[model samples]
Target: MKLDRTDRDIVAALQGGLPLVAAPYAQVAAELGMDEAALIDRLKAMKARGIIRRIAAAPNHYRLGMVANGMTVWDVDDAQVAELGALVGALPFVTHCYERPRALPDWPYNLFAMVHGSNRDEVEEKRARIADLLGGACRAHDILYSTRILKKTGLRLRRKG
Candidate 1:
């Protein structure tokens, strides 16, 4: 959708995050010199046009007492990868699960699942549960533990004319 000046302003304002106030839209509206109702309408329009997916807080699992995190890579049957991926993603412990092209000459695993827990044993138990769920479909796998966190952030907005 073609965005107007107001839409552009709203997007730019929300790129960081909505204010932690009772009336965040009103705050944004005040900053942009637009009414709260108009701002809400513009945001709804943006959602309808698929410009914005959803607005939510990206939580830090490690900070929230989740100390163990493992990126589990699996070599599963290509035909059932999507179905199994959906199943794996549905698990509460599995935060992220997706299929990617395996890096040739080095990596042979195409399916990846991320499991989090308070300790290594807990994370391993989750991995074992996932193995049981996949049955014999998964050929080989590995759990890559995180050594350090780099960076994390939400969406970035492009300036519009």
Candidate 2:
């Protein structure tokens, strides 16, 4: 979508993420020299127009004591993957889940689900549950544990020349 001057300003202000404060929106609105209601309305409109996909919290699981983070990969039946993946994604322990195209020969996993826990054992239990949920549909599966933290950020707008 074509962004207006104010819209670009809003995106630039929020690209780093909303402020970590009791009234984040209020602070952002104040910074943009606008009222809280107007800022919120603009955000809503932007979302409706698909300029902004979503606004969500990206918490640090390690700080929250969930040190064990695993990305479980599954090689599932092609016909059943979509249905089974939805079920896996709905699991309480699953933080996020999605399906990807399988790379033949070396990699065969089509479904990926991220599970986080305080330790590996807890994550294993969650994996077991997911395995049971997939049943015969899942031909094989594996998990890759995170070794380090990666910074996550949203889109950034460049300054006008």
TM-score of each: 0.80, 0.88
Question: Model 1: per-residue lDDT, tens digit, 42-136?
Answer: 88989989988878786677899988889999988888889999999999888889999978768988899998889999999999998988878
Best by the lDDT measure: 2
lDDT of 2 by residue, 117-157 (tens): 99999999999999999999889999999987887677888
Q: What lDDT score is found at residue 134 in candidate 1?
A: 86
lDDT of 2 at 58: 84
What lDDT does the true structure give each of the candidates? 0.87, 0.93
Clash tally, candidates in order: 0, 0
Single out the weakest 10-residue window by summed lDDT for candidate 2. Answer: 152-161
User: In candidate 2, residue 95 scores what lDDT?
Assistant: 85
lDDT of 1 at 20: 95
TM-score of 2: 0.88
* Prediction 1 global C-alpha lDDT: 0.87
Off by over 4 Å in 1: 1-3, 35-37, 44-50, 157-161
Regions more than 4 Å wrong, model 2: none
- The lDDT, on a scale of 0 to 1, for candidate 2 is 0.93
